[model samples]
Target: MKQLFSPRADRLLRGFGIIGAAALVLAATVGFALSRSDGTWGVGTPAAQPIPFSHAIHAGQIGLDCRYCHAGVEQAADAGMPTAETCLGCHSQVWNVSAQFAPLQTALALGRPVTWSSVHRLPEHVRFQHAAHIGAGVTCAQCHGPVETMARTVKTETQSMGWCLDCHREATPQSASLVAASHAQFGVEVPPLANCSTCHR
Candidate 1:
């Protein structure tokens, strides 16, 4: 048999394979870091709403509660958006003649709700209930930040899975069973805070 292969060729092939694997690992690490960055999650970026409603003026200065506009925050899965009628209830007495009130008035007359942009949104797979968190003694500022001081509502926290998990890990024992009662149907003891089923359902 003839010596068809050279030793140098085998060495070069091994070197290239090692370099390729190293490059792949580096790329994957960088990509994961970027994905977890605040810029990627739009943290601190204000969403543009149809109306420039100032939480600073309403909540901070006037001392309006979080539940005033988001009425269902205490009892529903969703923190409900305030109806146009809700805005007009007070603006109808104050800024009724201002040009800024035009859109609100029109929405009220048309019986259509004003579509406001959401500041903090989670993935569809994540099942978060505002009422449960509120009932557990978590304040609006905890997840939403100091919203009362913001002129334009922005996402203060990343609201990422890891971020949520960190809070759950540190939660008091009394507040730990966020969904334990609901998960009773599973027939097995479910770890309340850190379980995938607790939030993924």
Candidate 2:
């Protein structure tokens, strides 16, 4: 009882001060990093898609090429969504009898697009080029993860700018050479990777 309050109060105040200082330091570091040109600090969380499409069934089991459904990847800046016809190719015959295929069939027959929510979306200002990345020998798994194994697609990477830059640095040279190599690896004429406008715009 001599000074039970004095020492305990002092220790508690010191502890609180230390925690506050640490929090300030952490926030400052994150703020500074984000202010840089790369704009990658305090990475955001990944998003979930609406429909649970299994890449394992389509990519691994059926041996479907990425371009088959994402038909615009090589030719366009964006990889377009699968058309109703694309889904009907398989579903119209096999899963046609299942209740699960009912909505798909209805959409296909009516010429309506599937309301597939995008799982990997960036900020409106952040420009990403699917063609450039694909041309660079960057596998789909690099960004999208090993989608071939996923029964339902889930975002596996944070998709932060830092992550993209790390891959770009590693694949830059390979991307340059991939265009020079024979197209036999990709089964199409290789595209060049020299245009900055191809990606930045």
Candidate 3:
């Protein structure tokens, strides 16, 4: 039987396919880069919560301490979110009928917590311990910036490994506490906090 396509046509089709694929990959790469670098994602991206929970009004005006909401920061590996009871404790007495708080009331009545969007999220590959940071006297502001002043929660810092190592390598106010914790933790080997194992684990 005669060949359906000439050898030249076969080569041209293969070349076109390769070129088309490369172009598609280039376009996809550019789109992904724009997605990450644009105002859509990365540091300073504000999260819209189910309710308009203002840190400025609660923490700044009312002077509610961080611990009041993040009750497990000093004890748990993860800083636990505020329970529905915690929100109800205040909301039940103040602004209980506000339209903005409708979700809050519904969540409370349903015995579920408001699914607040995460503002400062790290990659799944990395692990962060809130207890260790808290024990080291690294105040929330050291990394989260002045959160009390934010009307809406925003990622103020680049939660990158290099950015973390830079802070760890510096002589911060938490050095003393870190040293103390290190002594209690490591006993003798004073491993640098900037070590890959310090954070990557």
Number of the top-ranking candidate, with TM-score as the measure: 1
Per-residue alpha-carbon lDDT of candidate 2 for residues 71-132, written as tens digits (9 for 90 to 100): 88876778998876787777767665666656566666787887777667687866777886
For residues 77-168, write the lDDT of model 3, one tens digit per residue.
87888876787787776655577767777777798877888977778878788987888778899888899999988876767665777777
- Name the lDDT value of residue 173 in candidate 2: 45
Which run of 10 residues does model 1 get worst, by summed lDDT? 176-185
Full candidate order by TM-score, most accurate first = 1, 3, 2
Order the candidates by lDDT, highest first.
1, 3, 2
Give the runs in model 2 whose Cα sits over 4 Å from its true position.
Answer: 1-52, 169-201
List TM-score per model, in order: 0.76, 0.62, 0.67
lDDT for 72 (candidate 3): 88
* Residue-wise C-alpha lDDT for candidate 1, range 95-179, written one tens digit per residue: 5668877778778789888878886778899988888788888898888889999999998889989898998766643543454
Error of 1 at 6 (Å): 16
The number of clashing residue pairs in each candidate reads 0, 0, 0
Best-matching candidate per lDDT: 1
Which pairs clash (backbone N, Cα, C closer than 3 Å) in model 3?
none
Candidate that beats the other on TM-score, 1 or 3, i.e. the better one = 1
